[model samples]
Target: MRRLAIPLLLLLAACSPANSQPAPPVGTKADRLLVDKSERVLIAYAGNREIVRYSGIRFGDAPTGHKRFEGDERTPEGRYTINGRNPKSAYHLSLRISYPNAADRAYAKARGRSPGGDIFIHGQPNAWPGPPIARDWTDGCIALSNAGIKQLWDIVPDGIPITIRP
Candidate 1:
């Protein structure tokens, strides 16, 4: 199953087109972010205007369903905030996602499990020896190319609402 995901992710990145290279340049910063898991697309919105759309997003190993517990390897589904940014992260750059809302914690606790946290929308691992994207790899956070993340890092500010949908 894991082996299959790697190839699928590689294909996903290859086939999907990225609109991150918006021409004419965007003049305003993004106020919200939207992730469509089925299409592997992330869109940033300034007010009602769509600024950029990033395709071929990589996810966790499972790549299905809302994350319920630690080690589920499932990208979470719901609304969250860009709580913080990491300039000195393990990845090229990272914007922390605030997962495990109160509801998530309650659900996991009911099942005697930890609801897991520390998710982020980030780029490739720093000092990685392999290609930029060898796999759709992360515990359960969103992954993007170095250039894609750099573009996002420049436009998206902290405390913006981000919604991840199935």
Candidate 2:
């Protein structure tokens, strides 16, 4: 019984939420955001100084390559801006990403398809139970926790630059 109990406790600890680390100090202003798709992380920066890093991120259902068109189920890669904000987002809070840039539009147009837009860095689903989803789930957006998104919403204003990496 003792042996079984110790192993069970260890398993529970391993399955626990990874967002246990205290967030970095919030800054007065954040100018840049960086998303590492492969690494599944989103980082906020104040100039050259790193202010906040959010790990254990879940990306689009198709978690690789650049998003080219609507319903691609892949996150777009490259430079973009925080073009909008939704204080009453369905998924807690959301910061809109400016996808379908000129290059994106051109590529999709050449392919005779619409380059999808309406990408965002958002929070978890409001209806879900228990902890956050543990896998890639968004259609073509970035997802964080409700609390995480709130913090981000407060700091990262519209027009901030974001660079998404493959």
Best by TM-score: 2
Q: Tell me the TM-score of model 2.
A: 0.89
Q: Model 2 segments beyond 4 Å from truth?
A: 1-10, 16-27
What TM-score does candidate 1 get on C-alpha atoms?
Answer: 0.85
Task: List the global CA lDDT of all models.
Answer: 0.87, 0.87
Each model's TM-score? 0.85, 0.89
lDDT of 1: 0.87
**How many steric clashes does model 1 contain?**
0
Error of 2 at 131 (Å): 0.9
